[model samples]
Target chain A: MKLYGKFFLINLQSQMQYKVSFFLTIAGQFLASISTFLSLLFIFSRFPEIKGFTLNQVLLCFAVVQMAFSFAECFARGFDRFPSMISNGEFDRVMVRPRSAIFQIMAYKMEFARLGRFFQSLCMLIYAMIACGVFWSLSKLAVLFLMIICGSIIITGLFLVYAGLTFFTVEGLEFMNILTDGGREFGRYPFSVYGKEVLKFLTYVVPLALYQYYPLMYLLGKSDKILYGFLPPIGTLFILPCFAFWRFGLHRYKSTGS
Target chain B: MIEVSNLTKSFRVSTREAGFKNAVRALIKRKYEYIQALSGISFRIADGEMVGYIGPNGAGKSTTIKIMCGILTPDSGECEICGRIPWKERTRHVRDIGVVFGQRSQLWWDVPVIDSFELLRDIYKVEHSAYRKTLDELTQLLNLNRLLKTPTRNLSLGQRMRCEIAASLIHSPKVLFLDEPTIGLDAVSKIAVREFIKERNRNSGTTVILTTHDMQDIEALTERILLIGRGRILLDGNMRELKQRFSRHKKIAVAYAGSLSSDMLSNCDGITVREEKMGRALIVLDSNLLTVSEVIEMLSKTVDIKDISVEGVTAEEMVVELYKAYRI
Candidate 1:
């Protein structure tokens, strides 16, 4: 944790070096994400509800996924550039360190610029809370929080796998982007709206529904089993396989030329 | 302490022909050739001995270092460092060794040099007092007090190189493996780094293994040199011993008044006349077989010797000759 903080501070200082560029990127990110919000709004203008859920409920889903996505991207941007790290001889530097490779990679990069989308998503979450008619309980609130944390971990895990794939094929970047950006775009609506097949794929394959739909159902009073609320935290274990793959990739890294 | 026997590593490298179409075709149907990076190589270094691991490029220098530092595992080999296999016992093995990859740095680029050092101290779990003592010693020896506060990216090549060396030493490992530590540094920084390395090895009894293209580094830092070519140990012996074995040829520049008789070279045990042009004649005399004074006296008795100069084989030329012999 101490090392994480030091890394965070280093990244903060590095970003602050170019204040104008940082703010511009944040604003640009904010604008880019707002289009998704606007599209959801325009769709709801024609249809009063998405399946059984109202605009308010769907907005809440959108906000939760966005929050998780933004937070994960903010922290794990290091993995996003893993290919360049290998090509630029940075991986060799990473391997010699006494610390854990994951933490060091995480500490090496932090995407503060993505905070723009985070702020926009947060505001949507607050408005959805005011607009939605669902009653709030301490257990429900806890589940909501767990959902976001688990969602972040799952997405970060996907990013880790994406990076790990770079070990075998340096140019396989676009293929992994399907999971990262594709998951985020598909995540705008609750997994159920995509029908049973899509939800099953997300549940068993990527575990996107593990954090977004199943646990979320309990939080919104769709299910009575309180255990559902705890499932999101359990979903975080998806990173295990991803981390193992990363280790495997590291073993295969024939470090590039000097 | 280190023990190794019959270490070998091979890599399967994809081969490709030229042209964009060919590259695309390779993507579709690729052929791979196996590269024997290490071919049953074996050697042992007693603790505290500075062994210069020298090799031509692509001769598995980096591969061997990686294996020794626990970054790589050989296909079939036995390596025990400090009573532990490097790759099998990576965490424990790494605790006792420090690696400085010259082209790469262990320091975080955006962080100050001191911050990197402190992080290393924590990562290594060095006791606070011991960390402080080691930091002070390294800073004083490397003259790093001024460079500590600067972000690594802002420092010049020389400044950054000094910090790179310092970053690796913060843990005070028993063995220090330097892969081209003085590469691309200005002459001044090179000497400073050399002095600091020598001092660390002498005062602390830290084992230093340096791999560099600069032969001077071997001459100054290590008495023993291990030459590798084409994934094989071609020569491994003391520097003086290598010199005497390959020191049969020495250049003698002669300025004759007019002409020198061919019979003048006949009296010498083995004299190879390299070039005899104009008033000056250049001949290579076997120094190990005949003393320079004896050759000069013998040459003077037959021809008018205006001025004469004898040159011993430098490490640079000796290395070039060795490479030529190996054809690596």
Candidate 2:
């Protein structure tokens, strides 16, 4: 944790060296997400509800997925950039370090600019918390927190899978964007709105709905079962196989030229 | 100590012809050619020995270093460093070694050099006092005081390289691997880097394995040379002995007051007149067969010898000769 702090501060200092570019990137990230937010608003303006859920209820789902995604993007950017790191031989530097390769790569890069998206999602989450008609309770609040936390873990696990694949082929696999970026885009509405088949696919294959949909059902009072509220923690288990794949790929790593 | 025995690694490289049609075909069905990077190579280095690992391009010099540094796992072989198998105990093995790849930069480009050093210090888990002591020593030895405050992107290549060496040493690792450390430095920077490396090895007893195409680096820093070619150890011997072996023929440039006939020296058993002009001649002679005095006496007999100088074969020429001899 202390080493992570030092890495964080150093990365901040490095980014701050180009003040204008730093601010511009943050602003660019903010405006880009705002367009997505506006698109959601345009859909709601055309229809008051998506699949019998109010705009505020759908907003809650969007905010949770957005916040979790941006959070993962902020911290796990290194894995997202793993292909370039391998191609440019930075992964060799990571291997020589005394720390764990995962830890070193996490510290290698941090996308603080993604905080713009994070802040926007925080605002939407707060608005949904007040207007989405959920009763105020400690357990309900805990489920909301779990949704974001485990949602980020699931997304970060996907990023790990993406990074691990780079060890086999030293290029970013474009199809992986379907699970990572596509999950967030498709997640703007609750998984149930996508129909039974898509919901089953997301639940069984990727488990994006384990955090975003089932626990969300408990949060919105659609289900009173405690198990639904706790499903997100089970979703965190997705990281295990993803991490195993990463380790397997690491063993097969063939470093680029010196 | 480092021990490598029967190490072998091969890579499967996908090949395609350079055309849109071939590229599309490769996308559908690719053909791969296997390259044997290291083929049953082995060597051992005891504690505190600075050895030069030299080879022609793509002869597995970097492959050996990468394995030693715990970066790549050999397909089949045994490699143990500091009593631990590098790939098996990677994290633990890496704690005792430092590697510098000259073509890459490890320092954070946008941060001051000291920040990178501090981050490295933290990464290595060095005590504050120990880190301070090592940093002070490195700053003084590499003259990094002025450059420490500058961002790595802003510093000159030489200055950045100096800081790079210092950063790697901040933890005082037991072994240091330098792969082409002086690839594109000016003369002064090269000398400075070489001097610092020698001083560090002498003072700390750190084992140094250096890989470079620059024979000057080999000549200046290392006593033992491990020459690899075609993914095999071609020669392993003392630097001086190899130089002496290649230095049997001595070059002598002669300046005289009058013209000399090239046939005069060409007719001799051990001398070959390389060049002859109106008043000067260049001669190559086998030093074992004829002494310098004998050649000078013979030259003096034919022409008024004004001045003469004897030169041995340089390390560069010796390496080229070795490469040619090995047919690499």
Candidate 3:
């Protein structure tokens, strides 16, 4: 943990070297997410209810998914940039170190620019809480916290899987974005809005609905079963297989030219 | 201690002609050819031995270093360092070793060299006191005090290289692998690097495996050399032995007032007159068979000698001969 803190500080220092570029990138990221938020607003203004869920409820869902995505984008930037690491032989340096490769790669890069999207999502989340009529209770707060943590884990797992695939293919598989970026886009609305087929796919295959739609339903009083509120922790189990895939990929890792 | 036997590694790389249509065709049906990077290579280095690994490009020098560094696993081999197989027990084995790939920068590019060093200290879990002690020693020995505050990208190649060496040694590893460490450096920087390496090896008894294209690095730093060509060990011997074996011939240039007679070269067995013009003659002689005095004596007896100088074969020529002998 101390090592991680030192890495964080070093990365912060490195990023601070280019003050203008750093602020510009953060502003760019903020505007990028803001555009997505505006698109959401336009859709909500046209039709306030998305499959029986009001605009405010959908905004709450969008805020949660956006927050999770931005957090993963910040902390898990290494996996997102895995292909360039492999191509440039940075991965070899990771292998020679005594530390775990994943830890080193994660520490080597920290996307502070993603904080722009994070704050944007935080604002939307607050506005949603005010606009939506759900009462603020301790249990509801706990479930909401669990939803964000579990959601970050799921997205991070997807990034890991994406990184693992680089070991096999020469180029990064761009179609994987349909699951990652597409997940965030589709997640702006509750899974039910996409119909039952999409909800089942997200639950059993990707497990996005387990932490997002199911517990969200319980929090919104659509369901009274507390079991629904506890499903996010179970959804974190997806990380195991993603890690297993990474280990397998490590074996087949053919390093690039020296 | 490091031991490697029968190590072999092959890579299957896709091959295609360069053209618009060919690239398009490759997308549909790519073909790959297997390249044998290391073929049954074998060697052993005892603790504290500095072995210079020399080879032509694509002759498996970097591949062997990569395998030994635990960055790449071989297809079939037995390699053990400090009683641990490098690839199988990577974390445990790598803790005792440091590797510097010359073409790559291990330090964080945008941060100060000291920041990178501190992060490395934490990653390697060095005690604070030990880290401080080692950093002080390195800073003194490598003259890194001035370069510490500079970002790696801003430092010159020589300066960055010094910090690179320091970064690797911050953990006080038992073994160090340097691939082309002196490449693209000026003479002063090269000498500094070589001196630092020799000092480290002498002081700590740390084993060093160096791969470089600079023959001077081999001649100046390492006593023993391992020559590889075409993925196989071609020669393994000490510097003196290799020198005598491949560089016994010396070139002798004699300037005389008059041209030499043809009979002057007839009786000379080991000496070949390479050039004779304008009262000067250049002769090649095998010094092992015929001494320089003998050649000069043989020449002076026939032609009046004004000035004579003999040149022994250089380390650079010996390397050429070695490469020629191996046909790589």
Candidate 4:
């Protein structure tokens, strides 16, 4: 961990060398997500409610999922672009070092530019929270924060699985973007909005609903059941299989070039 | 200490033919070809032995190094480095070994050289005192004091090369594998690098296995040469023994004060006049048949010699001829 921190510090200092680019990308990340906010605005303007849920409540859902994705992509950029690392001989260096490959790869690169989308989505979320006018309790608030943090881990876990698959073949990486960028796109609305069959698939197959649908239902007062808030933590378990697959992929690695 | 037996590795490469149809068909139904990189290679190096691993291109030199360094696992082989299996116990096995690829730089490009060293110290979990001791030793030996403060990107190529060598030795590994360490280096830099390596090998008794195409490096540093061609060990013997065995012809360049008639030189036995058209008379005599002293005695009796020089065949020619002899 200490070595990883030092590497990250060095990388961060190097990245900060371009002050204008850093700040501009942060601003760009903010504006890019506004289009998603606008789409929600159009739908809510017509119906005023999405399946008995108000526009503000649905907007909050959109903001939380975007926030989770941007956070993971910001810190876990190493695994996000791991194919290039292997091709460029960085992974060989990682293997020879007397440290964990994952920790080193995490510190390989960081996409601080994603902070743009993070704050952009965050602004809409705050506006929606104010408009919803829900009185918050300590337990309800805990679940909301838990949902965001746990959702990031699940998403990062999926990225790890994607990176692990690179050990075999990197020819078909675009296929995985469906689960990553595509998941974030469709996740703008609550998983329940897609109906029971799709919701169950997200819950058991990919577990996107465990963090978004069930937890959002509890936070919105649609469910008085305290257990609804606990489903996000269960979603965190999805990382285990992702990690197991990574271990298997690592053993199968055959480095190329001199 | 390293040991290996019957090591093998092959790669599946996609084949492509020249045509638009083939290129389009490759996307739908790809044809793969297998290349046998290593074919039952076996060798054992005891501690403190500097072995030169030499070979032509695509002769499995890199594949052997990769397998030993735990980067690739062999198909059917037993390799033990200090009694530890490299691919199975990769982390533990690599802790005692250091590797240097001439083309790659392990140092961080933007950070100062010392900062990269510190990061390596943490990665290797070296004790503070030991790290300092080794750093000081390497700094003094490689003359890295001035370059340590400079970022790797700012340093000159020679300066960075010296620092790269230092970075590999910071942990005082037991074995070091150098892959073309002197490639593209200036004469002075190459000598300095060679001197530092010799110093390290002499003082620490670190087993060094260097792979290079420069015959001078093999002649200067290593005693045993393992020459591989076409994924097989073509020759494995001492440098001196190969020199004595395959050095078929001896060179004799004579500068005579008086020109002799061609009839007298043609009558001499066990001599081949390699160059008669040149200003100086040159003769090639079989070393196995006649001694240099006997040839000089015979020539001096008949021809008035002003100066004469004796030379032997270089290692490069001997290796080329050896490869040809085996039809590799």
Candidate 5:
């Protein structure tokens, strides 16, 4: 953790070297996210609810998924771009260090530009909270906070899975994005809206719905079952298999170049 | 101490022809061939020894280094460094070693050299006092006081290489693996790097394994040479033995005031007139067959010698001769 802090500081200092480019990227990220926000507005304007859920409820889902994604993108950007690290032989550098490869890679890069989407999501979250006025309670608030935190972990697991695939073939694997970026796109509304099959797949296979849909349902009072509120913690378990896959890939690692 | 025995590694490379039609066909039906990169190569280096690893391009120098460093695993063999198998105990084993690739920069390009060094300190978990002391020593020795504040991208190749050596040493590893550390360095910088490496080895007894195409590097630093070619260890011995085996000939250049007939020295055994000009004669003599002084005495009687110089064969020619002898 201390080394990660030092790496964070040095990477932040590196980004500061290009002040103009840094701000431009942040602005670009903000604008790119705004288009996604505008599409949500256009769809919500067409119908007051998506699958019987109000616009405010859907906005809340969108805000949580976006916040969690941006958080993962900001901190775990190294895994998201692991193929480049492999191709450029940076992973060999990580291997020579006396630390675990996963820690070194995790601390390798930090995309501060994702702060643009983070702030945008925070604003949407505030708007959704006010518009969807649920009675305040400590457990309700705890569940929402845990939902965001666990959602980031699940999303980070997806990034790790993506990075793990690079050891076999050091090329960008596009299909894995269906679970990462696609999760954020589909998580804008309740998973149930996607029908029974997509919900079951996300639940049993990827487990994106454990944190996003089931827990959010209990928080919104749509489900009286208290078990649903605690299910998000199980989503953190998804990282275990992802990490195991990473270790397996690491054993089969064939470094590029000489 | 490092011990490698019967280490072998092969890579499966996809093959295809160059034209567009062939490329399309390759996409449909790919053909692959396994290229044996290293085959049954083995050597052992005792602690605190500076050994030079020399080879032609793609002679498995880097492959051997990578396998020992735990970057690439070998197909079949054993490499134990400091009582640890590199690939099995990667984290523990790597803590005692440092590697520098001449074509690669371990320093973060956009960050100051000091930042990278500090990060390495934390990564290696060096205590504050130890880190400070090691940094101070390396900074002074490498003359990196000014370069540390500069971004790695802005430094010259020589300056960057100096810092690279420093970066790899921030942890003060027990064994240092330098792969062509002097490549592309200027004369002064090369001398500076070689001197620092010698000093570090002398002071701390850090084992140094260096690989390079530069014969001067081998001559100046390492007493032992390990030559690999076509993925096999061709020669393993100290400089003197290698010299004695391959460098059996000596060159004597004589500049005479008067014209000397080529037939005059031709009668001498084991002497060939390699070159002859208006007032100079270059003779190649096998030292085993005939002594330099004996040939000089024979030449002196034939001509009025202005100047005579005898030189032993250099390491450069010895390597070329070795390569030719092995037909690799």
Candidate 6:
């Protein structure tokens, strides 16, 4: 943890070298996410609700997924850019370090500009908290916190899988965007809004809905069972298999020619 | 100490012709060719020995270094460094070694050089006092006091390279692997780097394995040379002995006041006249077969000799000749 703090400070100092470029990237991130928010609003303007839930309920879902995604993008940008790291021979540097390769790679890059999207999601979360009409309770608040944290972990696991596959092939695997970016867009509505088949796939296969949908059901008082509120922690286990895949790929790692 | 035995590694490279149609075909069905990078190569180095690992391009010099540094796993054979198998105990093995790739910069491009050093200190878990002492010594030896404050991108290549050597030593590793450390430096920088490396090895007994195309680096820093070509160890011997073996033939240039016929020296065995002009002649002869005085006496008999000079083959010429002899 201490080393992580040092890495964080150094990365911040490096990013601050170009002050204008840093601020512009943050603004660009803010504007780009605003278009997604506006599109969601346009969908709600066409109908009073998506499926059986009101706009405020769907807004809560969108805000949670957005916050989790932005957090992952902010901290785990190294895994997202793993292809370039391997191609440019930076991975060889990582291997020679006395630290864990994962830790070194995580410290290699941090996209602080994604905090702009994080800030926008916080505003949406605040508005949904006021308008969504959920009864104030400590357990309900705890479930919301767990949903965001575990959702971020799940997405980071997906990034890990993406990075691991790069060990076999150096080219960018564009299809993985379906699970990472596509999950964010499709998650603007609760998983139930999609049909039963998609919900089952997300629940058992990828487990995106385990955090975003089930725990959310308990938060909104749709289900009184405390078990639903605890599903996000179970979703956190998704990282175990993702990490195993990463280790397997690491063993097969063939470093680029110097 | 380092031991490598029967190490072999191969890579499967995808192949495609350079055209849109071929590219589309490759996307559907690819062909791969296997390149044997290292084929049953083996060597050992004792503690505190400076050895030059030299080879032609794509001759597995970097491959051997990568394996020793714990970066790549060999397809077969074993490499043990300091009682640890590099690939098996990678984290532990890396703690005792430092690697520098000349074509790449390990320092953070946008931060001051000291920050990278400090981060490395933390990464290696060095004590604060130990880190400070090592940094002070390196800064003094490499003359890094001025370069430490500047960002890596802002510094000149030579200055950045000096800092790079210092950064790798912030942890004071037991073994240092330098791959092409002086690829494109000016004469002064090259000498400075070579001097520092020699000093470090002498003072701390740090084992150094250097790989380079520059024979000057080998001639200046290493006593033992390991030559690899076509994925095999072609020669392993002392630098002095190799120089002696290649330096048997010597060239002598003479300036005289009178004209001398080239045929006059041709009668003597093991002597060839390289060039002849109005008042000067260049002669090459086997030093083992004829003494310099004997040749000078014979030349003085024909023309009034004014001045004479003898030269031996240089290290560069010796290496080119070696490469040609090995047919690499």
Tens-digit lDDT track of model 1 for B14-104: 9999999999999899999999999978888899989999988899888888888877778898999889998777778888999898888
| Candidate 4 chain B superposition, TM-score | 0.93
Model 1 TM-score (2 dp): 0.93
lDDT of 5: 0.90
What would the C-alpha RMSD of candidate 4 be, to one decimal place?
2.8
lDDT of 1 by residue, A99-188 (tens): 777887887789999999999999999899778766778878888888888899999999999888888888748977777888888787
lDDT of all predictions, in order shown?
A: 0.85, 0.91, 0.90, 0.86, 0.90, 0.91
User: Mind giving the per-residue lDDT tens digits that candidate 4 earns over A1-258?
Assistant: 677788877887667777898888887877778877888889888997877778888888888898888888887878977998888877887887777788888888888888889888778778777777767788877988898899999998899999999998878999889888888998888988878899889999999998998888888888888898999889999999999999999877877766
Q: Model 5, range A1-258, lDDT digits (tens) per residue?
A: 877888888888899899999999898888888899899889989888888898888888889899889998888978986899888888888999999988888888899888889988999988997788776589888888888999999999999999999888764499998899899988888999999999999999999999999988887889989899898899899999999999899887878766
* Steric clash count of candidate 5: 0
Error of 3 at B301 (Å): 4.4
Tens-digit lDDT track of model 3 for B1-328: 8999999999989999999999999999999999999999999999999999998889998889988999888999899999999989999998899888888999999988998998898888899999999999999999999999988999999998888999999999999999889888899999999999999999999999999988999999999999999999999999889888876799999899765885557566787888888998888888767898887777788779999888877888999999998899
Question: For model 3, what is the error of residue B269's alpha carbon versus the real structure, in angstroms, after optimal superposition?
Answer: 4.7
lDDT by residue for model 3 over A1-258, one digit each (tens)? 788888899889889999999999999989999999999889878886778998889889999999888888888878878999999999999999998888887877999988989999999999998888999799998999899999999988998899999999957488899888898988998988888898899999999998899999988899999999999999999999999999999888889866
What are the per-residue Cα lDDT tens digits for candidate 2 across B164-265? 888888888999999889989999999999999999899999999999999999999999999999889999999999989999989999899876877878
What does candidate 6's lDDT look like per residue over A110-150, in tens digits? Answer: 99988889998999999998889998699899999999999
- State the DockQ, from 0 to 1, for candidate 4: 0.60
- Report per-candidate TM-score of chain A alone: 0.96, 0.98, 0.97, 0.94, 0.98, 0.98
- lDDT of residue A77 for candidate 5: 78
Tens digit per residue, CA lDDT, model 4, B43-128: 88999989999887788998899889888888888999989998889889889899888888889888889989998888888899
DockQ, model 6, C-alpha based: 0.78
The list of candidate 1 runs beyond 4 A from truth reads A222-227, B255-269, B273-281, B288-291, B301-307
Q: Rank the candidates by TM-score, best first.
A: 2, 6, 3, 5, 1, 4
Candidate with better TM-score, 5 vs 6:
6
- Which regions of candidate 3 are displaced past 4 Å? B254-257, B260-269, B272-282, B287-290, B301-307
**lDDT, residue B88, candidate 5:** 93
The residue ranges of model 5 lying beyond 4 angstroms of the native Cα positions read B263-269, B301-303
Residue B245's lDDT in candidate 2: 100
Clashes by residue pair, model 1: none
DockQ comparisons of all candidates to the true complex: 0.52, 0.83, 0.78, 0.60, 0.71, 0.78
